[model samples]
Target: MSTTEVLHHHHKHCDELFADAEAAGLHGDWAASAASFARFRDELLAHFATEEQVLFPAFEAATGMTGGPTQMMRFEHAQMRELIEQMEAALDQRGREAFAGAAETLLMLMQQHNMKEENILYPMCNRTLADTVDVAAGLRQRLEEACPVSA
Candidate 1:
């Protein structure tokens, strides 16, 4: 599969997990909420690491552009991580309003982030990485390792 295809699949997987966590918490299922949020947090962090540590660096090397879209993506990722931390804390406290509010904010941020990645970065990665064999494969392998196929 292409880089875009694989990363897009991961996006869907993460999104499903996000929906599960948000729904569980919003519906007052405290136990399910906590468990699902934990899973979602773990998967989200793994996804972020896959992009920041592997995909972004590889794309930078391939294109020789260090401070382009990838930089912006890294910034957004840090923002998302902070929100996730807050959400996790809220879940711990069983603060329904807090968790839901954070989830709403995260949902918006994720929508924008995923759009930029799927429409721009993923295509660029597909094109740029196509110049060399195994780079895309390596990225896919790294992602799969970071987040298992539990989806």
Candidate 2:
């Protein structure tokens, strides 16, 4: 499969985990909710790591657009990281409202961020780097190492 297709699939995985965490929290099961949230966070971080470390660099090297779209994506990634840190604090305290509030914000941010990546940047990556040898290799390596086969 293509690189964009792989990333799209990963997005769906993350979304599922996010929904699981949300459900667990709303169910009032504290331990299960924490575990679910941790799972979601792990997948989310892996997704970001692979995108930032592998995909973005490949796209930038291929397209020579380092200061453009990839820059914006990196900025958004940093913002998401901050929200994640806040979520960590909320989770630590078992503060349901705080966690839920931060999660809502993160979900909104993720939706917008993912739209741009899926519709705009990913297509660009597919078109620009399809012939390159390392695109798929890099994706597979990160997928194997950073993300789980199933979650």
Candidate 3:
């Protein structure tokens, strides 16, 4: 499969995780919320690593645009990671206010990040990196292996 197709599939799972976390938060279920958030964080971290390590480099090579899309994505990933840590800390402290604040920030960051990937980065990679069949296949295989059907 192509990189964009693989990312699209992963995005669905990401959306589900986000929805589950949001539902848990809405219900005031701290344990469930924390679990969901942790799952989301793990999945996203892997996803980001895959992009940073493989997809972005391949895209930059193909398009000859160094420090473009990949740089923006890396920055966004860092922001999200920090927010995830804050959320986890809040959960550890059992502080509702902190949790709520972190959750809100996470939600916004996730939504925007997903949009940027879906609307811009993924399509660009698909078009520009179409010739890198091995790269795309490797990414697809890694993503599939990392995130099982049950996940």
lDDT of 1 by residue, 17-125 (tens): 9999999999999999888888788777877877787778878998899999999999999999999998989988989999999999999999899999989888999
lDDT of each: 0.83, 0.80, 0.77
**In candidate 2, how many clashes are counted?**
0
Q: Per-residue lDDT tens digits of candidate 2, residues 1-151?
A: 7766777887888899988887777666778978888777877877787788888888888778899999999999999989888877877887888888888898999999999998999888888878463444555665566546551
| TM-score of every model versus the real structure | 0.87, 0.88, 0.81
**Top of the candidates by lDDT:** 1
Using TM-score as the measure, what is the rank order of every candidate, best first?
Answer: 2, 1, 3
lDDT of 3 by residue, 42-91 (tens): 67776777787888888888888887878998899899889878877877
* Deviation from native of the Cα of residue 141 in model 2, angstroms: 4.2
Candidate 3 wrongly placed segments (more than 4 Å): 131-151
Give me the overall lDDT of model 1: 0.83
Query: What C-alpha lDDT, on a 0 to 100 scale, does residue 133 get in candidate 2?
Result: 38
Q: Rank the candidates by lDDT, best first.
A: 1, 2, 3
* Model 2 ranges with Cα > 4 A deviation: 131-151
The residue ranges of model 1 lying beyond 4 angstroms of the native Cα positions read: 131-151
Q: Clash totals for all models, in order?
A: 0, 0, 0
